[model samples]
Target: MIPGVMEAAVLNKPMDIELKQVPVPGIKEDEALIRVHCIGVCGSDVHYYEHGRIGRYVVEKPIILGHELAGEVVQVGAGVTNVSVGDRVAVEPGVACGRCEYCKSGRYNLCPDVVFMATPPVDGAWAEYVAVRSDFLFQLPDGISFEQGALLEPLSVGMHAMIRGRVNPSDRLLVTGLGPIGLLAIQAAKIYGVTEIYATDIVPFRQDLAIEMGATAVINPAKEDLKERIAELTSGRGVTVIVESSGNGRAIPDALTTVNRGGRVVLVGMPAAKEIPVDINTIIDGEIDVYGLFRYANTYPSAIQALGRSDIDVERVITHKYALKDIQEAVEVARTEKETSIKVMIYPQL
Candidate 1:
């Protein structure tokens, strides 16, 4: 073990973070010690830092916040074989009980007995080192930097959403909200061969970038009529698919109203609001298929393979980078709706 404590970004309270020296976590027989290299400043981490909780996961105690991460293995426990000392990898951050029915059925991501990082109570990886489960570590391919590796979490999420929506090459898609997930959704929709993609966002910067990233049309829901624009773009037939990544309370109804009679609607974002009014009558009338996403299962392998192909050009999605010491500033930057940036990565070793 390293004799002394390590520097960490500790959230002792809501809106309070300090650079403190904390003891490194111990590794078990099935775990490994990882020196965190890149930690992405995810919105959930910012939410916990700024608000002290996300939904039911209250920050009852001081917690370190970060989930999107990539690192180098510093030590491997006796039972570990897939990774060794000095291997660069991206940590999946979720450990599920293999004995569960969900795990046995290949739906491990939905396992009730799962310990996911950064979901409040559980301490996350915003530090110099972390003791991670060997099974959660994925080796980074050559030429894919730690920054891109950290991005795999969100990219995998978008890919899962795309898959859930049953995206087809002939489907016309409408994506509501261009936040990081929405931006990735736009890219993923293109990869799904959706010839026409309409993206809606309240921010002009994100709207412009959506166009740059190949959105057939970008509309500001506040400034433009969403239903009309989607209708006009799709020649009045409406979009064949809708990917709601914004988590905005009202987008649910917007999606229900904008999609074609038999279209598919996939929910990727977790809404913060207590509840949003949905047009049940309209959904029944249209016979729209709504799919809910809960993290991802059987996705990492496909995500890594797709990353190797590099045919999707998802690398351009990362818009900002910061050092580990600058994590607070990185959080603020990512919180900004004014900035034109999409994904933000924190390089811990830099």
Candidate 2:
């Protein structure tokens, strides 16, 4: 039975999280109402919690802030048929306008009218229940847990990064970050049959997690010379592809020099500076292809299949968990505990 009112971790302003009772959302004919089981605190979520905005997305009012989520379908609109009530599913946060040119060409992630959750103005699934479009939901098989289901959002980012970089068995991959997205990128590269994966991060905890996530070697950029190590690792040939998941300004420029000629670079993380100095000569002379990944498009089904592999365990990155009522602490841990915590998960139903 669904209740008329449910508790939500509402962000009224920067650093203020309150548990307020809000009316359960009404679904459209093509929507489904999910009883949120778990939600993961994303970097953007933490950013909003701290500064009240990410670039152009400003938190102007009270809003629920969590997009990485999975749950059970408690109710469905009359037109919903793909998923029934009681189905366990992962929620894809971006709802695109299906008729846009980008959507028609299978690049829906670039849709101009996308309604991305936890992005300002769109109240997300930090609440006990959320209503979303039915088509954006993917059913989780028996083997996939709700935690893994919630992680599909970040996993899809990695999958899309690999896809954008055109990663393959023959390519050597250099991942410049060991955060949740970077760790998942290493796993995604492994799934693509790329055995030689080198990951870099300043955090020892994340570097160790990188190795655990299937990186061939982990490097601490602060202590070791990244380009020199890459040259040594590849015998001066350099890696065939680079996935830049660390928003650190220096990571991209250093990674560009380590990419082999005619190689690809996928930029997954948003750096602090809107524009950072990059080696244009290196990009031009090396003929490197640079692709900016903005969330994922058309990756849910395949990502779910990939997660079924016995070795692909995404939960390894989840270092912290909390109940929805403790959202302030959850976001605080995620915001301040960068060195210790990787992914902070929340159980709304708790």
Candidate 3:
């Protein structure tokens, strides 16, 4: 018997995501049919809707608009075994080619042949049910909410950033953004034992939220001089590590200026323009370590481990929630980049 078709929010064009009835996605022999419960609205999804492009991936056809997902396994394929029906799970969206050199090097996130959800023509889990490979689904413990499960996708990036920075106890860490990613990085750094965390943001609410997230100090660059504040905070020596999550061109220069000699800087944000005037001379003179991120790898397990600990309450960063019916508004809210809105999620069933 044929299954029921469900309504999926498809990207029709720029500023347009229409609800279309798509056939229920089929499951492979090693796949499972999942009923999506929560899907986080990613920044890339908003970019694709507003500009119809993200880097070189052009939206030539209508595509679904979600990737960060938590769902229930409704049906398991004949060969599936990792998860059973009724298991709540978090879906890791990327399916990488195992034979790639990057994959063999344990850095599969850099795989050029990876097919990520919500990127261009790839349809994501923005509908009632999706067929996904069982290996990509991580079982959700009863103690964890589906929403938190959805958040792992982003939180893992933050965790990976901290790991990439090799954050140590009592290290002065400078985080130069207060978006959801930035906030999570704060929490990740806190858990990793960064003694004094300093945050910078133009948004007042974001700066306040940063303090709440365990920043020792919050600086508003719009109101304060970044270099002066860093110098004052560190007594002119500078921080040990910096995480540049703002994607603002100015933030890179400030990050370089704020770091101590031989400090590490990790860039997680994408700029409006890919080119940023990073003072290479300052980096060279300071002997700074700079790292670039492309999503994450081997970090989800740590994110799940953190969620189970109960020491860090990450859901506080969720400022708004939307149902599938309100997805258009959800994307629009994300685009506004308002201080009141940090991270937004779309619950298709709600």
Give one digit per residue, the lDDT tens place, for model 2 in 1-350. 89999999999999888999999999999999999999999999999998999998999999899999999999999999999999999999999999989999999999999999999899998999999999999999998999999999999999999889889999999999888999999888878889999999989899888988899898888899887898888888778999999988887887787788899989988888888888899999999999999999998899899889988889999999999998889999999998999999999989
Q: What is the C-alpha lDDT profile of model 3 across 130-154, one tens digit per residue?
A: 8888878899887999998999888
TM-score of each: 0.93, 0.98, 0.96
Candidate 3: residue 203 lDDT (0-100):
89
Return the clash pairs for model 2, or none: none
Over 4 Å off, model 2: none
Model 3 TM-score on a 0 to 1 scale: 0.96
By lDDT, rank the candidates, best first.
2, 3, 1
In candidate 1, how many Å is residue 61 off?
1.0
Please report the TM-score between candidate 1 and the true structure. Answer: 0.93
| Model 1 lowest lDDT segment of ten | 305-314
- When 2 and 3 are scored with lDDT, the better candidate is 2
Root-mean-square deviation of candidate 1: 1.9
- For each candidate, the alpha-carbon lDDT, in order, equals 0.82, 0.92, 0.86
Greater-TM-score candidate between 2 and 3: 2
